[model samples]
Target: MPATHATEHSITVAAPPAVVYGLIADVAGWPAVFGPTVHVDVLEEADPERGGEQLLRIWATANGRVRAWTSRRVLDPAARTVLFRQTVPAAPVASMGGEWRVESTGDGTSRVVLLHDYRAVDDDPAAEELIARAVDRNSHAELAALKEAAEQGELRDELHFVFSDSETVAGDAGDVYAFLDRADLWPQRLPHVSRLDLTEDEPGVQHMDMDTRSPDGSVHNTTSIRVCFADRGLIVYKQLKVPVAMSGHTGRWEIEPLGDGTVRVTSWHTVTLDPEGVRTALGAEATPAEARALVRKALGTNSSTTLRHARRFAEEARARA
Candidate 1:
């Protein structure tokens, strides 16, 4: 038997076992709670019988770089425990699996334990050490975030929305991601964009500054960061500088091939609205519905325009060929 690299870490959270378990049980929401998790895609749901497998693809930060992998998990809420095994382990990790156990101390506090067992792909100590450090760092951050979220009585509800707009293109889906990937050309390709700058300080991580002209000819300057998942055809982003009527914004762009020679491109947004900003931007008389309408229109028009252009590009290419 090969030697296994194992790690176990726990923290006492000032919350009931159930509260702590609730946060850990829903792995899909990990990105909002864990700092290192940029996005999570739940590929499969667990089967109730025979302890079926629940699969997930997680994009997370390891050693300051984004690393993505798939994991399979089984949950037993009755025992307040969950077991997980990474189906596709990241580099240097031959295999990895762990369990999360939450136990009540009967003193209004609960102990949350995170355990991991793994083996290196090769017996190289230095590579193994790097993997170990990443595991420890991520584990510690997750536990701390879990404690804070559970004790606070909510987990990421403040994020506030999820809205999406999609368009069907009679062209290749793979081509759509390119339109978004080449954002530096947007200013010339799209009229609504006046100025833009993009930088991938590290591959797949993008930082951009853009000035967009809204319908009323008003320009909004925004700074944003995006994590691109090229293989999966998805890009997730958060706006560092937002419009006057929003406190924060996050979004994703996804391209899906319908498999019938057509593709669907979607733009999704989740925003935290500042009611105060509404009054400032739209005057004190604007109602909530009006404010929301304005926000949707302002953002949708720009996104849809981009999607349309992508469609034209794809169709035009096919026509030329």
Candidate 2:
């Protein structure tokens, strides 16, 4: 028999156990809920009440490379726990399994516990510890998020809208593109933008942080990745980091020449909020319009500021040309 090693983590959620269990059972939604660190591909999902199974392929990236594994879920709704076992498709250095349990606390809340165990194929303690550490860190963050979702209700609302604005600027597309690519210019040009940082991992791909002052004078931070397409006069940015209520958000920008002496720029976005999750967190009185306004305000300000800066930068470049 393989040696059993375990690690346990618990979270108290304000939602009922059934609600939390259902969310847990919807394993396919994990990627959308957890963001980029984990990717889950569901091969199969069956009735949880019938004691059926789910087959999933999980891929995790670390140090900029991907590691994949396969696992099977044996669910028991009566017990409010799902047991998972690793299968043959896992990597040579990894074997993983875990149990997800949801229990009602009888005080209008749920207690969730996630227990996982993994042993290296070579039985290396150090390797196991490294994997354990990563898993623990990720699990803690994920569970806490679940608790927040369950207790606070849906973070996102149903109705969503995409708004965009742009302006033409006089300059070489390349010169203008280079300026937009560097996030470090934000604080100097946009008063609403407090701080900006850029991290480049490769040519044409960069991650950016934009810290802005909200209308209420509160600080709001958004992190996104910008991909430049000089050939198309386009620079697209998708939100990879945002406030909780603004989860599942994506945006893009397109810049095109007007065949005259100016570049046409456009920006747009999509956002989704979990209704139940928001209610649990913000109370039943939460309004979707309020959430939508928050996103609109952030995007509107950023887009307008970017356009103004682009125009000024383009004018300067044209003069120097």
Candidate 3:
């Protein structure tokens, strides 16, 4: 009997070959960058010259569920290529393997080819087309996101004053508390955040450099200290250094654990105005009421976007666990 298979897709990204390679090469970090759709757990690291390869356990969630697979990496650093073979353990009906090749195209552009070879374990003719189409769609989406992140440099400096309200996932306080304590996960999940360096000043107090992006494509670098009140189920972050537009800004995140493994999270941010810019941006003639309304609108939009990403992260973490 002939082995069943699926199709592959490719896309070119406008970035240096190294950058493109680095992004994909950092396979263990995929879950944070790729959102909740894909999870890559690293079983081994890469050592290119010695013919060492990375191994990853892959899980993909779609239509409210997850499917798991194991892949063995075969990487060629000199050629800038990484290939993987899917090992299907239980689900014999489907299999997938792919290669990522990066080549330099002059003028700081790189051509990326993502090719996949897939086979259906069982002889299910009808499922082949469906699986192929789904794989194509997913591959395209993944490339598009990678392109954006690469070209945009992953860190964004788009800042805004905002308020957010979140109810704990599954209504569990302990889970919520544990999740919030892991601030390291934020940089992985939020695209606008490039790096979050943290230092402990004292017990329960941590200082951090939050390198984030702003709405107008500017980078906002803020240094803040977070005081954790684990017993009270609260964490407060007070900004020490902020951009001109966000001077005197302070933000706080509060998690009130409700029974049944859920918590209510609320975030409040206050900004001190720069008279010159605010007057010019909002118009010197605009009243305080108008300014407040405008600020609220911007904040609301930011909050909504943040919440959507946060929810996806929380849901995926729960599912994976």
- Give me the candidate number with maximum TM-score: 1
- Structural RMSD, model 1: 5.3
Off by over 4 Å in 2: 1-4, 35-37, 48-51, 61-66, 88-93, 154-240, 243-288, 293-321
TM-score of each model, paired residue for residue = 0.69, 0.56, 0.49
Q: Between prediction 1 and prediction 2, which has the larger TM-score? A: 1
lDDT of 3 at 226: 67
Residues 208-259 of candidate 2: C-alpha lDDT, one tens digit per residue:
8878887679988888666666776666555666666655665556677788
| lDDT pick, better of 1 and 2 | 1
Write the residue-wise lDDT of candidate 3 on 168-200 in tens digits: 455445455555666677688666667788776
lDDT-sorted candidate list, best first:
1, 2, 3
Per-residue lDDT of candidate 1, residues 55-169 (tens digit): 9997777786667789999888778889999999887778889999999999989999999998888757887898899989999998987887777653235324567889898
Model 1: pairs clashing at backbone N, Cα or C within 3 Å: none
| Residue 130 local lDDT, model 3 | 56
Q: Which ranges in model 1 have alpha carbons more than 4 Å from their true place?
A: 1-3, 47-52, 107-109, 152-158, 168-175, 190-250, 256-264, 270-305, 311-321
User: What is candidate 1's TM-score against the reference?
Assistant: 0.69
Task: Compare candidates 2 and 3 on TM-score and give the better one.
Answer: 2
82: Cα error in model 2, Å:
1.4
